[model samples]
Target: MCHSQDRTPSEVGRDLVQWFLENQRDLPWRRDYSPYGVWVSEIMLQQTQVAAVVPYYLRWMKRFPDVPSLAAATEDEVLLYWEGLGYYSRARNLLKAARLVMERFGGRVPDTEADLRVLPGVGPYTASAILSLAYNRDVPVVDGNVERVAARLLDLDVSAKSPEGRREVLRAATQWLVPGKARFYNQALMELGAVICTPAHPKCLACPVAARCLALRHGTVENRPVRSPRPRWEELRVAIGVLRENGKIYIQKRPEGGLFAGLWEFPGGKALEAETPRVALVREMEEELGVRVKIVDKIGVVRHAYTRFRVTLHAYRCVPDPPGQIVRPRACAAWKWVRPSELDLFAFPAANRRLIQALRKAADAGS
Candidate 1:
């Protein structure tokens, strides 16, 4: 029973599960009840769209089908498969979780939500998701969609924008979860939000429980998920592009620390105060690659967000002027010039992929 004096969660839970059976999407993870499969899908789903995750999930499942397989895979190989999927930390955490499962649980994923949370990178939401979706356990799994749906249902005024506000919403959502049938119930609410109960112009008429929805009844569905105004993000001047020659693009592998480490990337860095992009590029190349480059044409710019900072990467196609032997100076592990066709052999950041695309276009135009 829900501790809150509101309506019993059991009835709501039953309605949701009943609705889900008739409207659930045929996701790959749902086809099987393997905890490893569910865990991989959940991790891949974090900060990634479902449409985008489909191929990656399928490829990853084929490559590393189980916890033991994932545990046996090298980090480089795992990152190769995970290329273009931002937030490299999630991939690293997946490996850590697999290793933990192999060593402690004899390569078996734990079924209980509490036990699942103890694994590296397994949070409250992820643990609950795995427990309910994979193991058919009763646990409150509140993701963004679930949060939005729950917020609209209860007409919660608390800010879901801030970190603390989001936490508060999680607590409220957990209070409304029905014990012992959380699997289908949680999935149903999530599905409803993903399809009909969208962020804007929700199909209230098609909602299963629209007649009982507090937001719809009160005409506040659009604004029910309240939040404080976002702070102005600090801007960064970034440099990114390929150093090219003879159909080979120069790339350097980042060190095993910081963002996108142990991954191949275009040689670029942040511009210091009042520094020109060319100056920054030259300095960064010298510092990171121990080589000199002659700036060519400005390729383009890519706008990206990383944590708290908003960055505008100024891309430029350049050529190594000095043509010196590449050296891995400062925070770099290795350097190489690889053809575009073989780029998949190494893991690269999204920005690097964009750089490669731009370089290929340049090569085609030059030809």
Candidate 2:
């Protein structure tokens, strides 16, 4: 109900920076503080939790240490390193942007906001994060955590993702950051939100800026960082086939620029309302691979969600018919036949990975 004009920006900034320096988590990206590290970490962190990103980051940095290394790698190999991290497009874009960095920016992560924004998948928040965190620019990075912190501290009247709300947060950040301390200041604000000023059950007592938070003073801490209503989940029934011949499974690399673009997936499609999953798998196999398959057994089912749709995937173990077992690939960028144990050579979507686990489990049990 009350606006956030009571506390001075400098006072809050001093407390946040001091607290963050002493409390920031020991993350891999923080250890090196290189622009390449910051860029990779920021992109990997998108729509993914920090805990989940750590291992992936470690592996990625090991494999592709610099922009040139990343640029040299093939897209499939890049996605292989980024397999479990959902949002396949992030991996794809990272590869594209890495090549662009090599071609356009002379193998350096762009320092200016404009140049950074032009990279594939680099948006306002990402650009700001790179500039401030890597280049020490006096720019603000207002991600979800920072938005939540700013909304509570500044008592934003609109949703944090809204344009006006972002402007309000940037205005507050511009006034608060100390000279030559943009990196620490931005990290502190985000770290505070991550650990102390959490979305639910915030530790107001532990928060260094608790005394200055207008939302806390007004008893609106729980409802401060208002967000728009999330879109309804669209339910889908998907059927995928783990078609095997001579002990190796068949998988397809999807063509560029569609749902799950360029990622590997088992052959199959949506099940009609009246048809069972087996029927759908058989139909898809005949249609896509130019062969008829016999549904040998049920492998497993996986549930996955994208931004707007949730899918219950049914995975079936299938083998081509004895006589007409010739495979002719269709509607795919590429196709591969590899042993189940050798599946790590290619990248697959989340559901397919789960299917692989179930496949292994079944094989183990059978043996």
Candidate 3:
């Protein structure tokens, strides 16, 4: 890779800013430029595609609109808005942060990176982004897109997944940051990476800073930003018990602070190596809900993939052994017996959503 330091960072920054002003996408977040909007958009954009987040962002803005509204919302309501977004913890943290901002910051999103970092789930990248974009602070952001751009622009040969590699990329981004033009500069760099300097096939012909890109000069843009190997996904078999009594289905809320936090789902758990789906359902019900269940029949299997693992959910229709014994939640946060028609009122995981649809279809056929 070539490191021709002929052009100054200021010159490169100016060119990128000019390019951004002309070619940037007309996103809804860009229209408002409010701190709340930027914070929500950045959170949603993490580990998700821009196209996927747009409608969600719009609906969320319409619903919550600002810090106080979000802070005042119940966890269930917040999770409802975030349904199908997959990562439930993001919504939980956003709610927590909103409440903290209301209590500590007087309902205003913090302006400085340090102040913003105190909020739950607000890391360096998010804090820097909110600061730079919303407050117009002269800070640099090094998200995946910006990291890729930096790797090619400076021809950094380090694997961005490594600690040293990440630090180097951040340093390069900071070094090239245009003071007083941070909002445009940061967005421009990220936009360039997203559209032009993409990972798979970068459009070098359209890149404004292509003239200054070291990876382009060295003909290694395709492989400039190296990544470490990702861990293999673990497969697990789960048994979900669809407990029904007097026309209401039993559902429980997941505990806060983990994957799918605070979302509603049918009671179930991973099957032990020696246990069948029915056996697992019996054990899971007794342990999780403190109630014995008699599995009536198999409902069907549903497969779902999470970020770290894949699960094959074996669902079964079950009845309380004692026939209307009080269903108590021993492991989860809460439990409810809701009419099947009321399932849509609660937010459930994607896998559970599929299960609900299947359950409804089965009920319809039986009726």
Candidate 4:
């Protein structure tokens, strides 16, 4: 295997920049570059495809145009814009970071790497990306695509998931970064990886840096940049209760600092072993809302797959029992009752979204 020293950094930089200028995709974030736009796009791009994030990013920019605008918006309003984008913590952290930027940095995004790192959800990769891409700093970014391209180019033997492998890839990327041209060079590297050096069936022939890629010479381009095995998927059975009273459905805000944080959902929880869906719904509603409910009928089931787990949601139509008490927030942060037509004002998880649609349809049919 050849080391990164085999190829000259200047040569790689020139080729990459030239290729990028000629062949970069016309993305919205690339046009009229702003630090806020770069930060938001970077967060949204995490674990989400480019095609999916494009429209969402456009909508977010329109609604929350600047850091002050984002900080001024409510959490519910922010999540409403980010409803379908999974990994909701990114949205929440963006809100936190925007507020911090307003208070700490005087409403302007921090330009220095150190200050940027201290912002919520702004890690090393994200910090480097914002500094280099938005501010044109001489910093290196080693995202998944960059790591894969660098590993193949340097023919690193270790998996990118390992610390040693990550360091080596970052070193290679840093060495190749063109001084005073980080904005273009980093984007070029990522663009090259996305279009040519893909994980499967990489188009090495079309790659601009094919001549400098060590894996190509070693006949191991496809096998380079190995990753560790993914975690096993855990199956969960959840019971969601659609409790209604006076033409309003009951919903609760999830607690902060966990999965689906700050989003709204039907009152429910994971079913215990051997517990029936009906029993689980009753227990969960009582525990979450502090109100007793009787199952009126079974609604429908919705299945959703998260990054690490798959859940089967059993939904049921329920009504508050006699001597209905004021719903209290026991397990959640807040509780509310809203008409089916008003659900769009709040953000809900994908599974709960399906349930909401079902409820709306049922209400319409009954009417």
Give all TM-scores, in the order shown.
0.89, 0.96, 0.92, 0.93
lDDT of candidate 2 at residue 58, scale 0 to 100 = 96
Per-residue lDDT for 112-134 in model 1, tens only? 77678878889988988888888
Model 4 pairs whose backbones collide: none
What range of 10 consecutive residues in model 3 has the weakest lDDT sum?
1-10
Order the candidates by TM-score, highest first: 2, 4, 3, 1
lDDT of 3 by residue, 107-190 (tens): 999998788999988998999999999988999988888888888887877787578778777777787789999999999999
How many steric overlaps are in each model, in order? 0, 0, 0, 0
Output the better candidate (2/3) by lDDT: 3
lDDT score, residue 324, model 1? Answer: 55
lDDT of 2 by residue, 184-207 (tens): 999998898888888889999999
Quick one: best lDDT, which candidate? 4
Model 1 bad stretches (over 4 Å): 1-8, 161-179, 244-248, 325-328, 337-340
Candidate scoring better on TM-score of 1 and 3: 3
Candidate 3: stretches off by over 4 Å: 1-4, 361-367
Compute the lDDT of residue 176 as modeled in candidate 4: 86
Question: lDDT, candidate 3, residue 24?
Answer: 94
- Cα lDDT of candidate 4 equals 0.90
Backbone clash tally for model 2? 0
Model 3, position 155, has a per-residue lDDT of 82
lDDT of 4 by residue, 159-191 (tens): 986888877887778888899999999999999
